[model samples]
Target chain A: MNIIVCIKQVPNTTQVRINPETNTLIREGVESVINPFDTYAIEEGVRIKDKTGGKVTVVTMGPPQAEDALREAISLGCDEAILVSDRKFAGSDTWATSYTLSQTIRKIKDYDIIICGKQASDGDTAQVGPGISAHLDIPQVTYVRKIEEISAGHAKVERLTEEGYEIIESKLPLVITVVKEINEPRMPSLKGKMRAKNAQVLKWNADDIECNVNDIGLNGSPTRVIKIFTPPPRKGGEILKGDTHEVVAKAADLLKNVIIG
Target chain B: MVDYLLTEEQKMIKELCHKIALEKIKPVAAEYDEKEEFPWPIVKILADSDVCGVYIPEQYGGMGAGIMGMAIATEELSWGCGGIALAFAATGLGTFPILLFGNDEQKKKYLPVIASGKKLAAFALTEAEAGSDAGSIKTTAKKDGDYYILNGTKQWITNGGEADIYSVVAITDKTKGARGATAFIVEKGTKGLEFGKKEKKLGIRASATREVIFTDCRVHKDNILSREGMGFIVAMKTFDSSRPGVAAQAVGIAQRALDEATAYAHQRKQFGQAISSFQGIQFMLADMATQVESARALVYSAARMIDAGSKDIAKVSAMCKLLASDTAMKVTTDAVQIFGGYGYMREYPVEKLMRDAKITQIYEGTNQIQRSVIAMNLIKELAKNK
Candidate 1:
């Protein structure tokens, strides 16, 4: 069984600061880390590889510096890594990013499963994984909390929901967006670090993956932000100042008005 | 212009170890200290993560990132707990004699397991009779046709009975003085070899320290490191290489104290404002920060010199160990002062940091010993100029 895991490098949210003048992130001194969510996806992929005796290839789409994320995945026991980076891929949104990832996966040509995090921490849109699945035209299970079993051409997994979870079965060549509850990521091993240090990350450009210019980068992205602003701080709720019986009646009236209105 | 840069691999190693220090080691540190137990759970985490193999060679199934890697990783681990960090670093202390002096057969036989981090290793040179004077050790290794019988008691051996492999220094011919000492590899399960009572310590209490008793414990002649009567050279060489790691540990301890003090001062108020607003408090923080950075620089430079294969490493190594450990002692004490009454309580971390800092000065040869080593080298170099 060959598994391919997708990961992204994002600014550590806690350290990131917004530049009020430019309305953009001030990344100068901020540290970059593998997206926290992606770690679980990578861990799950590696675990599957470990159990079934196969290879796990980790792929990512970002700037050249994003190679760090790939190397980090390799340090967690991924067999190989591919970095999709190019100047033309800049400012791509979820649609373009997912299409580019799919194109890279298509170039590899042999994979039984593609795994990804439910969302990137920087932009919690939660659209990229499902977008990639749509591009590949494969069955996908999002918010996967557990993988029950995987064999020749099928896999059983638990998809988390607001209510609870739903067990789903999917055929080979499927996509999965994993939740944090799926698995705990392992620390980088000593030997793995040596290998990652020497390992060559295959760098691919948009043209290298045979992608069209019209469907890549800023030109290809359909969504545009008009403006960005911090939401107004919430005001404290009104407190009922009266006896308990009177306060209860007033609170009930307020709740009834809200529901009825 | 001065610039500090890390190789891509080193950066990854630093980040990884830093995370482990924060997430794994820090939480359990106080518990282990309180219980005075060997942090076997932490040892398992370090070994399983293959952290202990960072200094070992690649041919022996390790990262082979060398002394710099070890120092970087050591500093991070020490930030969590000095005693536990020593337990991990002592493996390198034990493995270094073989790495530096062992022949191909000895290296091949002893290194792979250590590299795999499957078993812990120990260095046993200090005894009741010989701490700084390794030459006066009473442990004797007698050659007896294909085997040597080791007999004596080694005190305060780190990793002690828990370690699987031991690099022991014993006197082969007492008449030759320190030169008569020979290094030998003694497996833990050897007959007549036993561990005496474990010593209770003031700090780094999480790590086990005990007496290794060797009474007619026969070791194979093939297990000899380098050659006969070269144990002193092996011991000295190992210390030269390992001191930077101890220095890094000191730097880490100092950094942790500074971190705690700075964070505490910002929130802790006296009069009508945070203590951080006071010039006195600010000055203490600035000094603590400076010391930590300076200690780190010296430790890193010494480690780099070792990796670069510098021949005159004795002075620099001694300087780093002395400066960093002394800095640790001062910074931790001041951190406690900054905490004032709160720092004195065991519930707070600064007190533990202060306690931990003291051992760095005492072990891996005391700061006094380090000072002498530096002065002796300085005098020798001055005479050479004439």
Candidate 2:
């Protein structure tokens, strides 16, 4: 099995602050960390490789500094790392980002499984993983909480749902977006850190992956962010003041009105 | 938080240990303390992360960062919980004799297993009759053919019942006094080796303390550490190397106390103002911070000197242990003072820190013994000058 894990480098959400005047994120002086969710994706990929004896290649799309995230993944037991970076790749939205990653994976060619986090902390859209699956025209199972069994050409997994879960089986060369229930990530060992320090991260540009010029970067993106602002604080709900019988009748009437409306 | 100019590897060790302390150890520290249980789960986590090998040689499946690495690791882990950190630090104390004196075959046989964290090791030097007067230990190892039969009991031994390997000191020749003593390796399951019930303690309650007993327990001659009649030298040398680790634990406890006190003072209100606004509280915080920082400096300096293989380390090592332990005791008490009535309650954290701080001053040789060692070194230096 050749596993591929896609990750993102995002500002640590705990330390992020919004610039009220500009209505934009104040990225200055903020520490960058792997998108919190991506940790589970990397862990699952490593797990799969460890069980079946395969290689885990972690890939990320960002500036050169994103190489640090790849190294971190390596320190966490990812076998190989690739940094997909290019100046032209700037300002890409979920669609373009997923398209670029799919092309990069296509170039790698021998992957049996591709795993991604359900969503990135910076962008809670939860679209990139499915977008990659669509571009590659492969089956995808999102919100996967566990891998029940996996073999040479098939995998059985549990997909988390609002009420419960659904068991889903998919053939080889499929995509999966994992949830936190998948596994608890392990800490990096000293030996792993030493290997990460010296490991050479393969860097690929848009042209290196043979991406279409018109379908890569800001111009290629379909969605746009017109403005960014913090939502206003929620107002308190109205409380009924009366005897228990009267209050119950009034609450029933209000709930009935809401349902009817 | 002053910059000590750490190497990249050292910084990595510090960062990883801090993460483990915060994320894994701190949350369960209180529960373990309450249950008085050995932290085997946390120890397993440390082993999985290869932290058990931080001080061992790389050839023996360790990181080989030496005493400096061990000190850094001990401080960070102790910050999470002093008692929980003992499982690792006590193992370091036991392994020091083997690392310092074990022949090639012994190191090959034991260090790897210890470095792998498959087994914990312990040092046994104290006995019912030998507390500060270590030369008077009653445990005797009589030679019979190719084996030495050990008899008597060792008291208040850390990691006694739990550790898989033990470095025990016993009297081989009564007439030779200190020189009559010898050190030997004793496996936990050896015939006639037994452990007494665990002793209750005022602090570091999570750490196990028990009496290690021997009754005609035979250890092969090959298990002897160095030559015969070198037990006291081995014990003293081992202390010289391990005292910095104890000091690091003290610095960690003091630092945690200072942190808790400072954070509390900023939020605690009295007279319609934060207690931090009062000069009295500010001065106390200042003194605590200063003491913690100085203690940390001394520990790191002493640890670095030992790592650099300095021959004249006994004086500095004793000084660091003395200063750091005393600082931990005083600072923790002041932290409780800052917490006021809340600090006295079991519900609060400062009390536990105070309790934990008391043990550092008494263990790895008491603060009094540490002072004596420093004075003796000074006197010897004076004699050399004369």
Candidate 3:
């Protein structure tokens, strides 16, 4: 089995600071980490390769520095890494990003399964995974909580839903967006870290992947951010000090007024 | 934490162990300490991360970073929980004899298994009668045709029943006094080998301590370390290498106490102001910080000296163990003082740290024994110079 995992490099959310004046993220001095959710994707991809006796190839599309994230994925047992980077890819939205990745996968041209996190923490759009499936015209399973079974050319998985879960059976050549419930990620071993340190990540750009010039960068993106701002802080509610019955009636009356208004 | 000018590999070991400490060990430290349960889960985590072989050579399937790497890993894990970290550190203590004295076949046979972290190893020299006076151990290893029958009880043995391999020193020929002793590799499941009930400890309760009993337990003559009548030398050499590890554990425990006290002092209010603002608290914090840093410096230097293949390291190694363990005791006490009433309560972390700090001074040979070793080295060096 040829397994490919898509990952993203995002600012470590805990250290992120927003500039109140510019209404933009303050990126300077912030550490970059592999997206928290994408770790699950990397782990799932590695697990599949472990069971099927194949190689796990981790791919990411970002600036040159994003190689660190790919290297980290390698340290976590990914067999190979590919970096999709280009100046023209700047400001690409979910559609363009997915398109570029799909083109990169096509260039590889030998994948039985593609794995991705349900969403990137920074964007929270949860679109790129499904978008890649759509671009490739392959069956996709999103929010996969468990891979119940996998064989020669088929897989059974549990798809998490609002109610509970659904068992979905899909043939080979499928894209899966995994949830945290899928598996617990392993820490990198010294041997793996040494491998990551010396491993060379294959770098490609817009031209290398043969992406359509019109559908490869900022111009290709369909969505645009008009403005970014922090939401207004919620105000504290008034305390209802009285007997239980009285407080309950007062709370009901206030809630009714707000709902009616 | 001041940068000790560690190499890149050492830094990686520090970072990875720190991550394990924060993400895995810290959360469960309290429960394990309370329940007195061995930290098998944490041990498994350490094994999965390949932390078990930080000091072992690459030929034995280790990272080959040496003693400094081991120190860095120990300090970080102990920062999370000293007791939990002992499961790893004590294994190092047990494996050192093999690393330092075992022949080629023994190293090939044992080090790889230990390096893989599939099994834990323990040192069993301590007995009911042999605390500081290690020369008097009565566990007899009587020679048979091809095997030695071991008969004795080892007390206060860390990782006793749980460890798969034991490096034990016993009297091979009682008539020769200290020279009569011999060190042997004894597997856990050998017939006549049994373990007594676990002892309740004031601290490091997450670690297992029990009596290792051998009743007519037979060990192959090939298992003898560096031939017979060299048990004392083997035991001493193992201590020389492993003492730094114990010191690192002390430094880790001390550093944790300082961190907890500092964080608490900033938020704790007194006289309508943060307690940390007062000169009294400031002085205490300053002293604690200074002591912890100094202890860490001594430990790193001693560990580096050993790794650098310095021949005369017994004195410095003993000094590091003595100073760091003493520092841990003082700093932890001060940390509890900073926490005041809350420090005395079990609900707070400092009290447990205080409890944990006590054993570092007591174990791996008492502070008194360390001072004696240092003094003996000092006198011998002076005599040689004269």
Candidate 4:
């Protein structure tokens, strides 16, 4: 079986800042890292490969500098990596990003499984995985919390929900979008690091992946960012004070006023 | 002496240590290097994380980590910033002599705060006249009623200027040579003890080093380590246990070198193909890989021998230090070569790695002294074991 984990390189959130005047994020000086959430998808792919005999390949779409993220995934035990990077692909929104990723997945053509983080920290759309599934016309397993089983041609999965989890079986060539709670990521080992250092990063672009000009990248993006802005500041909560009995009576009085009013 | 292989919890330590090194150490390394400054922030990081006294006994409020666990954490942390790790290593190197041989009072008075990172410590042994030849130390600690007046200069002391506690070595008897050397724990800012300016180093800039001077510095008679005359043996014995740690640091350095070189080779191009695909570069890569593995085997072997009750540790420890340091120098040098012109520039990561690699050879008993240690210890072991 072949598993492809779609990872994203997001501007490291720790260094990010919001412009006070313009209410936009400051992207400069922000380093890129594998979306903290994507790490679990790569880890799950490796775990599944470890259990069954197969290969784990990672694919990402971004600028040339994004290669670092791919190499990191390789270090985490992904057997192969590809950079779906190109100048023409710049400014792609979630719709275009998923379309590009789907094209690259199609180029691979031989994969039995595709996995991705449920959402990118920068985008938080949680739409790309399902979008790719829709683009590829394959049944998808979203928010997968566990892999129940995998056999000759099918995958048994347990997807998480608000109340509990549900087990579902999907046919071959399926897409799985994982949540952060699914499994803990593995530490990169000496051997895994060595492999990551030497692994080939096949760079594909819109043209190489055979994506139609109007169907991907900025042109294909149905949702333009227009202008990114920060959310408004939160207001302070009410203050309560005094000893236990007095505080409780005062709180009861406040609650009565809030509800009665 | 117990098994040193990592348990599940240790893997967590390893991951956390790596994260700290990359996140905290790398950014400031250049600033500290340029100014010859102490990275107080790194100390705060280590202290807040409560990882400083890795070897301190739990009863004394330490993690009480074994030698191997300490070695692993030290190795990973050293990779990101060797100087910072050196500053923290001073905690163990300076106090292990105390923890290993200190009386119950010493343990109760010192171990807890040192391990907790509340009080930084320094180990003073290399004197102006005595480095590898530690017996020739000229520092004198004359007995004075209830105290000992220490008069000596300790060379290249880690945390010399910033530490709260210092474990110093001085001569108590001239005629006895190595046997005359005595060890004492002198708290910093003592009336007679003063530190000189920091040393300008090629790398590990985030951690500071300096010369500590003692002008009639006085400590209570109880500050002596093991015994008055055994200071030389105790300091040397400390190295026997600590040399593997330096070797572990080299492993971290070499690992980073391999990482940078491998990443560069694949991305960098020559002729019509990726440089990594070319046979000539492949040979170099092969050599780099082999050197790292050899150094690792020697290092882990010495670490295991230390855990296995083998007196053979001194020789093996020296061998590991020599091999690993040498490998770090070579691998990092080649890593620069792999980067070609970019390796020479400061902006590139490999250049910093190259600079970082040089000191491993000079510090922790220069590779030359490591050879002497191995040769002498080997002769002694073979004569008995053979």
Can you tell me which runs of candidate 3 are displaced by over 4 Å?
Answer: A18-24, A235-261
Tens-digit lDDT track for model 3 on B187-267?
Answer: 989998999999999999999999999999999999999989999999999999999999999999999999999999999
> Between which residue pairs do clashes occur in model 3?
none
Sorted by DockQ, highest first, which candidate order results?
Answer: 2, 3, 1, 4
Over 4 Å off, model 4: A1-261, B1-5
Clashing pairs in 2: none
List the TM values for chain B, per candidate: 0.98, 0.99, 0.99, 0.94
Each model's lDDT: 0.91, 0.94, 0.94, 0.83
With a 3 Å backbone cut-off (N, CA, C), the pairs that clash in candidate 1 are none
lDDT of 2 by residue, B1-386 (tens): 79999999998889888888889988988898899999998888888878898999999999998999999999999999999999999999999999999999999999999998899999999998899999999999999999999999999999989999999999999999989999999999999899999999998888999999999999999999998999999999999999999999998888889999999999999999999999999999999999999999999999999999999999999999999999999999999999999999988889999999999999989999999999999999999999
Per-residue lDDT tens digits for candidate 1, residues A59-155, read 9998888998898899889999999999999999999999999999999999999999999998999998899889999989999999999987899
Encode model 4's per-residue lDDT on B124-202: one tens digit a residue: 9898788778788888999999899988788989888888888888899998877788889899877899998888777
* Steric collisions counted per model: 0, 0, 0, 0
Residue B286: error of model 3 in Å? 1.9
CAPRI verdict (incorrect, acceptable, medium, high) for model 1: acceptable
Say which prediction, candidate 2 or candidate 4, comes out ahead on lDDT.
2
How far does residue B29 in candidate 3 sit from its true spot (Å)? 0.5
Candidates 3 and 4: which is better by lDDT?
3
- Model 3 residue A237 lDDT score: 82
Query: Could you tell me the lDDT of residue B341 within candidate 1?
Result: 96
Whichever of 2 and 3 has more DockQ, that candidate is 2
Candidate 2: Cα lDDT at B231? 97
Off by over 4 Å in 1: A18-29, A63-65, A85-97, A189-200, A203-261, B1-12, B40-50, B173-176, B308-311, B375-386
